[model samples]
Target: MARAFNAKVRQREFYPGNLVLRKVLHIALDFRGKFANKYDGPFVVREVFSGEAIILSDMDGTENALPVNADALKKYYP
Candidate 1:
């Protein structure tokens, strides 16, 4: 089972200064039925931890209050 799961999992890595989008949790204020975007921000990668965790900053330069798991983010082009 572990091998099967690992076979399909692609690794995600980010480096400082790269642009990325953050996953948006579907909270009450953000719920918009089925068509809402799943992620937000073209946030800048502020810091990268050892594995599967990172810190991000808004384009305007304010850091987020919490560190996010790498899986909750994806690379952003542009």
Candidate 2:
């Protein structure tokens, strides 16, 4: 079962200066109302860690307080 799950996993990467969106949790959506977005920001990548963690910056150019797990991020296509 573990092998089957691992096989379905795909690898992704991000680099500093790339734009990405962080996943918004369902609980957060409830407070923001029904139309709230499922993802937040084309937040900038301030740093990347071992290909598994990333530091993101707000759009206004301030770094976030914590490193986000790569699994919580997705590349912003636009």
Model 2 clash pairs are none
Model 2: per-residue lDDT, tens digit, 1-78? 999999998879798999999998786337558777889998999988884889999989999989999988899979
Prediction 1 TM-score vs. true: 0.82
Query: Where in model 2 is the C-alpha error above 4 Å?
Result: 1-9, 28-35
* lDDT score, candidate 1: 0.89
In TM-score terms, candidate 2 sits at 0.76
lDDT of 1 at 77: 94
The 10-residue segment with the lowest total lDDT in model 1: 25-34
TM-score, each model? 0.82, 0.76
Cα-based lDDT for every prediction: 0.89, 0.89
